[model samples]
Target: MTRAGRPTRTVLAVDGGNSKTDVALVREDGVVLAAARGGAFLPQTAGVGAAVDVIAETVRQALAPAAGAPPYADHISAYLAGADLPIEEERLRDELIARGYGGSVVVGNDTFALLRAGARDPWGVAVVCGAGINAVGVSPGGEVARFPALGRLSGDWGGGYHLGEEALWHAARAADGRGPATALADAVLACFGTATVEEAVIGLHLGGLQIARLHALVPPLLAAASAGDPVARSLVERQAEEVALLGVVAMRRVGLLGEPCEVVLGGGVLTARDPLLMSLIERRFAECAPHARLVVADVPPIVGAVLLGLDRLGAPPEAYERVRAHFSGAAGRAAGDASGEEVLTAPAG
Candidate 1:
């Protein structure tokens, strides 16, 4: 029920990753009315049945309030992080529909959602460097392609988790004096609030420190490298090269990189202000893809999820800019409007 005496049409948008799941309900005009979030739903991390349950629970929580609220939840859309294969998509979609969302569910990988946020041409590439890394390519012919992401063993790299692990490995080696001495040894010691690498090691062994916490070392390490630290410089260069390789591989998979193409970069590392990584990535991409142009995406991943929902409703291509505009405004936006309640707000710049 609305002040206008009409039912508020609503769409549910969800973004599920290995760490957490987020769901939100938005009006057709893009105003967020309600949101909810839940735990990890990666089938590989949590069992398939468990992942399905988490997804269902998150979506239900977001829609549950709509039953009696002014806005009524109707259609449902989801962009999930590990739902890469068709079977995964089918299984999740079936479960969502069976759970009462029925017939109005749109399910896809996070890569697809990110692509929707960055490019309207449908023939562009999207590269993300988050806890993990992935790339998606959309052809003008409505065909979409993605490369197999085999975590670290694929010889492919560049992601927060991977980079964090790398930082730890470097520090461990440097501490053991088995590797070249660099500013990283001092930086790592300082990051763990310790006076020596031995203290940091003791903290790591005692479970007081986390592997992911090493991600905090990345920016300073990159800075040290930019200031001429060989070890730090090498790691940043390798990450940049690998990310660029992923973009090239994805473009080749979709058959659209040689002559003219667009590469959209998203995620934490790429979004950072470091020019070394971006510069190296550009140099690599230029050599591999020739005419490909790498650019930053205007919309974040949440907006990508919203776009996928709109696409499910058959919204025209022109809807992208409108939706982007709607969410970009402030003042009237609720406390947790843009991102769902579950999303941890990154510290402000």
Candidate 2:
């Protein structure tokens, strides 16, 4: 509450992804009170209730030292992975509201958070190529264009995990003489510390080595591509094509194809800024959507979640600055500082 004795408006902002979850408590004036990180929010595998439970635990940790009690915030802005369909988002929103975490709730695909985080304006396109791939677009008139993003079933590809599998596929085929020999064979073997690609494949199949480690192969795959390995370069080129295609299609769908539009790119793969992949992406966008201005997201998606909440509360520009400063400053202190548990006191009135 403010020193004037009026009730304070707060926002419970959450960004949950396949890798981790981030929660922050921010006053309507943009003062960040607390933040915490938790496990993945996998609604498909863990079920909707269990997935939200993860967020609940993290929110509890963030608010334990704060001054408020239940319904800690005026609104809950949750941008989560696995909330792909409108039905899924609705179900999650209903569940969150049922918990009475806040007076109101808004749930959206995490790609929306990525869009809000990077785009110069509220309306633009966001393409995230992290553990998985997805795209979302918002038109100036408030029209939204988004994909189902159900992986292969939804005609999506070119994420870290998928690239890893592709690298192994080509390497295994090359090792067996079924495909053209390339440097990826050796790169794959070295990535897994195995003498042969076959050993890595067998290990993955037998669960001796975790399949998640496949994501690690992406670096070597990109390196091989950068070093002029034909097979690796082809894979990277394909990934670039897909990324540009998603953005272009989204822009076309939203009637931004001929006009100038911001194409915000995020996720681990794109953020790595590999020379070859980025170059190819730029070229593809140039050819396909000439006016598309590509921008790599500089801030985490959690910031977007907070911004969305602030937008809902009709926060002022000063509020936006304060929230950005807090998270950006925390980020500068340590690479992973923002993801750790933290509680802060609001400034004196």
Candidate 3:
């Protein structure tokens, strides 16, 4: 909706992750008309049908505020977690286009969004540590470096999921006196409310306990590390090393290791601002890439989606500024307002 009889130009942007997905309808001038957030849309985890259904409904609601206006946007940008490979991105893009989601659809790994959102230029590295770990780098000349990120099978490591599993392994080993004694065994037992680590492990194997819930153990493991637990501290240090290594490798591949480079850290574990973890990561980077500018992303991933969309649309500079102001002023929560709905929706404006 625009002045008297004019229809405004808009872009449909999406940032889909493992746990949540955010969609936005942004006008050419950067006015966010509507926004919506929903559950995961990962085809690998949710199946293709359910993933499409969830993504479609989420986008529909995001465009609901402006009813009869051409629903067609000048461009659409979708950054999704499971769209790791180029073929995967192309398939998803075709699906979105088949549904008439936009005039043109562009899809890429969600980590690229994290990278663009935190760094001003395309030349930098981004390491995301959340449900999983991923890294991407872009050089000044437009070359890129990225990982498959298909879990341990792909030789990838370090994330909440992996850290929690490591915690379980070390705790179980300590409980059986096969490894050095540490506070993790007691902490792990306390986290699961079990009498002992053995009970917890047995319950997990017998399906009495949820293995998916291991991600919740990350905080406790880090807390144990902060409390001087040797095993826990070692786990945390290893994660930091892994993160730094990912960034360094990406930088080296792009021939930016010797030059000053921006290394962006994002996702759940990194965004938590854990002192020991952050400091250890800094130490690791200091030893390898001394000129690295490490930045912990403060903006939401959707912001990156919108920024990319704006670039595609060739929107003016002020357009991007308006969008940034809206996000930053709202403290980066797109759904900061309550619209009196039973289910929460991220505010589009």
**Model 1, residue 188: displacement in angstroms?**
1.8
Question: Each prediction's TM-score against the native?
Answer: 0.81, 0.92, 0.90
RMSD of 1: 6.3
Residue-level lDDT of model 3, residues 10-70, one tens digit each, is: 8888899888889888987888878889888778867656776777778767766554433
lDDT winner = 2
Ranking by TM-score: 2, 3, 1
Question: Which is the winner by TM-score between candidate 1 and candidate 3?
Answer: 3
- lDDT: which is higher, 1 or 2? 2
Sliding window of 10 residues with minimal summed lDDT for model 1:
340-349
lDDT of each: 0.71, 0.88, 0.82
The candidate with the higher lDDT, 2 or 3, is 2
- Global fold similarity of model 1 (TM-score): 0.81
lDDT of 2 by residue, 103-212 (tens): 99999999998888887678999999999899998999999999999989989888999999999999999999999998888888788889989999999999988899
